[model samples]
Target: MAGGSFRKSLGYALAGLAYTLRTQPNMRFHFGAALVVVAVALLLGVGVRDLLIILFAIALVVIAEMFNTAVETVVDLYTAKYHPLARVAKDVAAGAVLLAALNSVVVGLLVFYPYLHAFVRFWARSWRGGN
Candidate 1:
């Protein structure tokens, strides 16, 4: 009974995560970027370990974006009017998200480049062999 309850709680948590990803524009962007990574990984035939690394990178960007959004929301709620300091704070928070997103892109390219090159080479070899 206790185990079942724990599993239900986990499910709810996962559902909440999904809801956030679906509803939040920034999260949706991150999710779309992640889908692109997954497509690249599939094309490159990424191994399990590489896949884990990619997942970690994606998670990092998503978490950073989420935190940035939360900070912006809190600032807006508290200030409710245009203030130079509030604008600076929001911009800084957004910049952090942008940095995280760029970092994730770099990490994805680094991790997948080798596999992509190898896959291309293998395809070329097989095509030549068949001819």
Candidate 2:
């Protein structure tokens, strides 16, 4: 095999995605979180531009997570036993994911905070008998 055709490459990419979803707990969690974020944005009727930003933020986190998983897997393959450089590599990859996650949180807050506040206020008013 001199390499795969485009369709085969796409299938292989999907297989890699499935493998990550299956084997990586954090990947699963990130995907779940992304789903929730998208759902909330839809419910809140986010503007198109904000929706795009939210999508970008979610993608960044997921992409970072995938990259981090790749780095960890390659590092482990390189060495079974503990190694300082492997630890460093894993830690740095994890840090990249952390940064992405944090950035997503910031974007979410920027986009959703006012809507969340309005939601809370509406609920509060309803609970207080429209006072």
After superposition, candidate 2 runs with Cα above 4 Å error: 1-4, 124-131
Error of 2 at 10 (Å): 0.8
lDDT of 2 at 123: 96
- lDDT of model number 2: 0.93
Candidate 1 Cα RMSD (Å): 3.5
Clashing pairs for predicted structure model 1, backbone only: none
Task: Compute each candidate's TM-score over C-alphas.
Answer: 0.77, 0.88
Best by TM-score: 2
Q: What digit string (tens of lDDT, one per residue) describes model 1 on residues 72-125?
A: 778979988899998988898889888988888888888888987887788898
State each candidate's clash count: 0, 0
